[model samples]
Target: MFWHRATDYILSSNYMAHRFCYLLQPGLIWTNVVMDSLIAASYLLIFLALFWMSSRLRQVAEINRYVWIFVAFGTFIVACGMTHVMEVITLWWPIYRFSTVVKTICAAASVPTAILFVRIAPALTRNMERFIFMLSTTQQEKDRALTSLIASEKLAVAGRISASIAHEISNPLESVGNVLHLLRTGAGLSPEMQRLVDSAQGEIIRAGDIARSTLSLYRESAAPVEVSLVPLLQSIIDLQAPALVRNNIQIQTRMRATVAIRAYPGELRQVLINLIQNAAAAIGEDGKIFVRVQPRRGGYSITVADNGPGVQPADRTRLFSLFFTTKGEQGTGLGLWLAHSLIEKLGGRIKFRSRTAGEAAIRGTLFNIWLPLGTPPYVPLAPFSSVQAGRRQMQKTASVASR
Candidate 1:
C-alpha cells in the first residue's frame, strides 16, 4: 500500500510539472524573471523602510501614544514584503504552496493593522493639537524672556547715566550751599528776606541730599546698623512735603510704635521715599495720604495708603518688574523694583493692595512693609537729632512764611 501511494504522488507531481513547462520557454521565462526581480527589488525597499520606521518607533516608544499601532503596521508591511519575496522564489522554483501560505499570513497582519489605524486616528488628532499649543506657549515664554533681557540692559545704562549726573551735580551743589550759608550769615535786610533765604537754603540742601542718595544707591552699604523707623519716616516726609503740598495732597500719620531695626538706613529711606512719592503721584488735588507704623510680633509694620487712581488689574502682577510702568515717559520704572530688592535684602517684606475707581468700596492703593526688629550693635545717635532739628527749622520757616 505504501509503495502504491508513493508512486501515485510522484506521477501526480510529474504531470503537474509537465503541464506548466510551457512557462519555461525563453521569452516567457525571461519576462517572468525580469518581473519577479522588479517585484523583489520593490519589496526589498519596502522592507528597509519598515525596518527604519520600527527602529525610530522603538526609540520614542515611551512618548508615542500609538506605538503599538505603529509597530503592528510595521509588522504588516514586513509580512507583505515577505510575500513578495515568496512570489519571486516561486517564479524560479515551484513553491506556489509556500507563496500561498505567506500571502495568507500577510492578509491576517493587514486586518489588525487597519483596525489599529482606525482606533488611533482620534488620539493622533488630539496629540497634534496638544503639541501645537505647547509650541505656542514656548514661543510666548521665549519672547517674554527676550523683552526682560532688553529691559535689564536699558536699566543698566540708566544706572550709569544716573551715577555720572550725580557726580557732576555734587560739586556745584556743594559750592552753592557754601555761598548760601555765607549769604544767610551776612546781616539780613528784613525777616521776609531771611525767610526766603532759609527756604532757598533748605531746597538746596534737599537737592544735595537727593544727589548723594542717588550716588549711594549704586554702591553697597557700609554696615547694618540699628535704624529708628519713626525718625527716618519723618525725615522722608519732610523731604517730600514741598511736592505733597504743591499737589494739595493732605498727609496723615499714626505712629503707634517707634521701633528700631537693624538695616541699611539709606536703603530703607529710599524704599519709603519711593512709596510715598508713588502715592503722591497717583493722587489728584485734594487727595489724602495716610501713613501708619505699628509693632508686630518680632517686627514692625508700616502702611502707606493713598486715595488716588489705583493700579489697573492687568498691571498689578507686573508692578515690581523692572521697566514695567504705567507712568509712560515720566517714569523710568525702577522705583518699585529697587524698593523690593532693598526690602528683601534687609530681611523684610513689602506688599500692596489696589482697587481701581468704581471697582471697589475704596478706590486707591495701599502698601504695607514689615521689618524685623533688632538692637543696634553700636550707638550711632547723632544723625537722628540733627535730622529732627532740621525738620523743626523747616517747619518754623514755613510757618513764618505763611504769616
Candidate 2:
C-alpha cells in the first residue's frame, strides 16, 4: 500500500508539472525536449517495475496470482495511455478539457490498481506459508526415500546370506526339539507326572513353532497385485486381533475413498503387520494405537500413531536401518527396515515423529505414510543399453574368478 501510494503521488506530480510547463511555453523547443525526456525516463522505470512484478507473479501457479497479474497489467496499460494523452494535450494542443479527462482516467485506473495490490497482500503471505510447508514435506520425503534405499541394500545382503543363516540355526533347533520330545515321552507312573509331561510337550511345540517362524524369514518373497487399500488394511487389523487385544492397542480407521493401488500385496500387508505389531508392543498393556486413512493434498495419508515410549533423537536416523533394534532379544531388527523398503517400492513414503514433553509424561510416536494418488508402477524394469548384458556378464565372471 505504501509503495502504491508513493508511485501514485510521484506519477501524478510529474504529470501535473509537465502539463503546466508545456502549456505555458509550447514554443520553446529545448524546454519541451528536456521535460519530455525526463517524463519518458520515468515512464520506462515504471514499466520496468511493472514487468518485474508481472514476472514474479508468473512464477506462482495459483489462480489468485494469475488474476492479480491480469488486473495489474490492465491497470498499467490504462495508466500509460492516460499519461501519453496528457503529454500530447499539454505539448501540442494546449486543451484544458483533454488534460482534465486524461487526469480523471489516470486517477480512476490508480484506484483499482491500488486496491488490487492490497487485496493480494494476504494471499502473498498465505502463499509463503504454503511454500514453506511444501518444502518441509519434500525434505521429509527425501529422507524417507534414502532410508528405504539403505534398507533395500541391507535386505539384498541379508537375502544373499539367508541360506547359510537358516542352515546354521536349523540343525541345532531340530536337535533340541528331538531331545525335548524324547525327554517328554520318558515313562513316569503317577497322574501328576503325566500332566507335567503333557505341559512340557506343549512348551516344546511352542518353541518349535517360534524357531520355524524365525527360519522362514529367508523364504519370504513379494509378488505384485492390485489390492483395494481399505479392505487390505482392515484385514491386517483382523490378523493382529490377538496381539492388539493382548496389548490393549485400539485400531481406528476410515477408508471410504476406496482407491485400489498397485503393490506387492503381501509385502504391503507385511509392512502394516510389522508396524501394527510394533505399535502394540511399544504400548505394552494400556496405550492406544490410532490408525487413520484419508485423502490429503491430492494424495492419501495413512497414519499409525501410538501412545508409547517414543524414539530418541539419536535413534531417529537409524530407525529403518538393518539390525537396528531396541527390543533386546525379542526383535530381529529388520521389521522397520523391511516395512520402509516395501512401502518405497510401492511408490509411497513413510515417516514418523517421536514427541515427548518431559520424563513425567508418556511419549508417543506417529508413523505416517503418504501414498500418491493414482496407480503405482508394479514392474521395475532396468533401462536398456547396448552394452548392458555384456557388461553384466563380464562383471559376473570377474567376480567369480576373483573369488
Candidate 3:
C-alpha cells in the first residue's frame, strides 16, 4: 500500500514539475538530448530510404508485385521512428502519457511487421536460392533471364499497339493504291511506263497483304484456326522482302503443304517471322534464304535456311536459350528462345544445324520446326503427366538434333 501511494505521488502533476531541474542536470541532460536526437534522425533517414525503395520497385512489374508487403514493413519502421520522436519531445515537456501512447502504437505496428516477415520468410529464402543459382550461371544466362523478364512486359503492351499500327498502315496504303490505280488505267502509256505502273500496283497489293497479315501477327486469336501455309508464309516473305532487298539478299520460299493446318495463326506467324528475320541477319549480305513448308508424318515441317556465315560452334549449344544472341548489341537474343518456348507449348519441337564461316563450301544455318497434329480449332489437348514432370521430360528426352 505504501509503495503504490508513493508511485502515484511521483507520477502526479504536482510532483512532475521537474523540467527546469532536469535541464540543470548538465551532463545527463545534454547526453539524453544528443543521443535521442541522433536516434530520431537515423530513424527518419531509414524511413526515407524505404520510401525511395518502394518508388523504385513500382517501376518494375515483377519486383513491384509484392510492394504492399514492403509498405507494411515501412509503416512499422515509421511507427518506431515516431516513438523516438516522442522520446526527444518528452525529455523537456514531461508528457509521459503521450510518450507511452506513441510506444504503444510502435508495439502494435511491430506485430504486423513480425507476422508479415514470418509469412514471407520462406518465399524470400526460395527467391534468394534461385538468385544465387542464377548467379552461378554464365553471365549470358543471367543477362537473358533479366532481359527476357523486362522484355516480356514490354511485349505484352506492344501487342495491342501493333494492332493499331497495322490498321493505320493499311488505311494510308489503300489511299496510295487508289492513286496508283488511276495512274495505271490512264490513256497513253509507253512500254516502260506500263511496266513500271504494273510493278507499282503489284507492290501496293503486297503491302496490303502485309498489313492485313500483320494484324494476325499481333492480334492473336484465342482459338486455333485452319491456317494455309502458302498465304501465311508468302505474307511473311512479303513482309521481310524490303529488308532482304536492302541487304542484297534473295529469299526463296516453297510451299508443298497445300493443306491447311490446325494452329494459332499468330503464333505460327511470329515463329516463322522470327526465323526469317534471324536468317536475314545471319546472311548479312549477298546471300539466299530458302523457306520451305513440307508435309511430315503427323504435321508439317517449316524450315528456314540461309547461306550466310553460320553461327559459331561455341554458340550453337546456347542458341535457343533466352537472350543468347550472336548479333551482340543488335540482338535481343529473345527470338529463338520464344520460338522454342512457343513450339513446345504448341506440342511441337525445333531443331537446327549450322556450319560456321569457311567450315564448308557454302556455310549457312538451317532451322526446322516440327509440329504435331494439332487439335481442332478451340479444342484443348491433354496435359502432360505433370507440369514439372513434363518439363523435366522435355529437358532430358529432347535434343537439338532429335527428330
Candidate 4:
C-alpha cells in the first residue's frame, strides 16, 4: 500500500517537494552561526586555492594523472563549503535553494572523475613500472632514452596527458547525440528537419570514431579490426557528400568487394578521406571522381581516381615521400604521406598512376591502395630500453618536418 501510494503520487504530475530537509538537531540549525560562517569561509578559501593550483597546471598543459583527482577533491570541498554557507543563510533567507543546484553539479563532476581515475589506474601502474625500469638501466642508456624522450617531449606530453581527458570530450558528445536522438523521435516534426537530424547523427558517429581511434593510437594495441570496406567507404562518402556536392564534384562508387578484412578502420577511413579530398581539390569544379573497391587474390584494391589535371611528371616520384605537397601554401603535405604511412602499417601499400594533359587525352590521377585480407596483427617494434615507441614518434617527426 505504501509503495502504491508513492507511485500514484509521482505519476499524477505531482513533482513539487514540500520543503528542504535539515540534518541538524531540532531548532539547533542556526544556534552556532558565528562558528559555522567562519568554518564555511575557511573551506571556501581552501576550494579557491585548490582550484587555482589545478587550473594553473591545466593552463601549462601539465595535467598529470593526479591533477584531475585533486580537482575532484576541490569540488568536494566546495560542496561542503557551500552547504555550510547555506546552513547559515537558511536561518534568515532561502538562499540555500541556489546552493542545492551547486551541490548537484559538484556531485555530477566528482562521480565521473572518480570512475575515470579508477579506470586509468592500471595505466598509471604500467607507467610507474616503465619509469622504474628506465631508472635501473645504465647511464648511457638513460642518457640516450632521455635524449629521445626530450626530442619528442611535445608528443610524449600530448600522448601521455591528452589521452586521459579525451574521454571527457567523448562523454559530452554522446550526451549531445542522445539529445539529438530524442529530438529526432519527438512528435510534430517535418521531413526536412528529419533529414537534418539524420545528418547530425552521422557526424556524431564520425566524431566518436575519431575519438576512439585517437585513444587506441595511444594504447598502441596492434590488434587488427575486422572491417568491411563497402559500407565503410560508403559512410566516408556520405560524410563528405555535402562538401563534394557543394564543390560541384560528381562522385561515383563501385563496390565489388563483398568481404571483411582485418585492418584498422581509422587508418582506412583517413586514407579514403585524404584521397577523396585530394581528388576533389584537384578538380576544383564540374569534375568526376570515382572510387572503386574490388577483390584480388589475397587482398582488396581500392582506387580513388579524379578526372582533374594529373600529377606533373617531375613531382610524381615524391608523392609518397614525407612532407611532399603540391598545394604549396595551402597544403601541409602530410595528407598523402600520412595515407602512405597508415597503409604501410596496415600491412599493405599504396600505388598511384597519373597522366598530365601533355601525356594523355584524359588527364587524371588515380591512387590505388592494396590491403590484404585477414592480415595478422604484428607486434609493435622500436622499443627504446623498456617502453616501445608509438605513433607519437611518427607524429613528432611529421611535426618537425612541417616546421
Question: After superposition on all CA atoms, how large is the RMSD of candidate 3?
Answer: 16.2
**After TM-score superposition, what is the CA distance of residue 153 in candidate 3 from its true location, in Å?**
1.3
Root-mean-square deviation per candidate: 12.7, 14.8, 16.2, 30.3
Residue 318 lDDT, candidate 4, scale 0-100: 91
| lDDT by residue for model 2 (1-403), tens | 9999755554443434444554566567456566656675676667667666666777666644455555565566656655654565455444555566667777787777778778877877787799899999999999878876776667656643543465466677677768757766776637786677677666666555444443343333334446677887786786577678876667777565566655555556667778888888878888788888887876678888888888777888999977799788998888997788667867888999886647437578989988766556564332122124545788999999999
Give the per-residue Cα lDDT of candidate 3 at 57.
Answer: 84
lDDT (10s digit) by residue, model 3, range 1-403: 9999866654444325334667577787678778877887887788788888889889987668777766877788788877877666666566676666778888998998898889988997898788777777768787767887786767655655666677779988899899889988898988899899899989889878877876666665556778888888887787888999999999887779877877877878899999999998877889999998899988989889998888898889999986679898998777888788778877788999999766888789999988766753343221112333544667777864485
Clashing pairs in 1: none
Leading candidate by lDDT: 3
lDDT of 2 at 191: 76
Clash pairs (backbone) in predicted model 3:
none
Q: On a 0 to 1 TM-score scale, where does candidate 3 land against the true structure? A: 0.53
- What order do candidates take by TM-score, descending? 1, 3, 4, 2
lDDT of 3: 0.78
- Superior by lDDT: candidate 2 or candidate 4: 4
User: Candidate 1 lDDT, tens digit per residue, 44-64?
Assistant: 677677667766767675445
**Candidate 4 TM-score over all chains jointly:** 0.49
Q: What is the lDDT of residue 349 in candidate 1?
A: 84
Cα lDDT computed for each candidate against the true fold: 0.76, 0.68, 0.78, 0.75
Candidate 4, residues 62-93, lDDT tens digits: the string is: 24546776777787777777777765665545
Worst 10 residues of 1 by lDDT: 10-19
lDDT of 4 at 142: 80
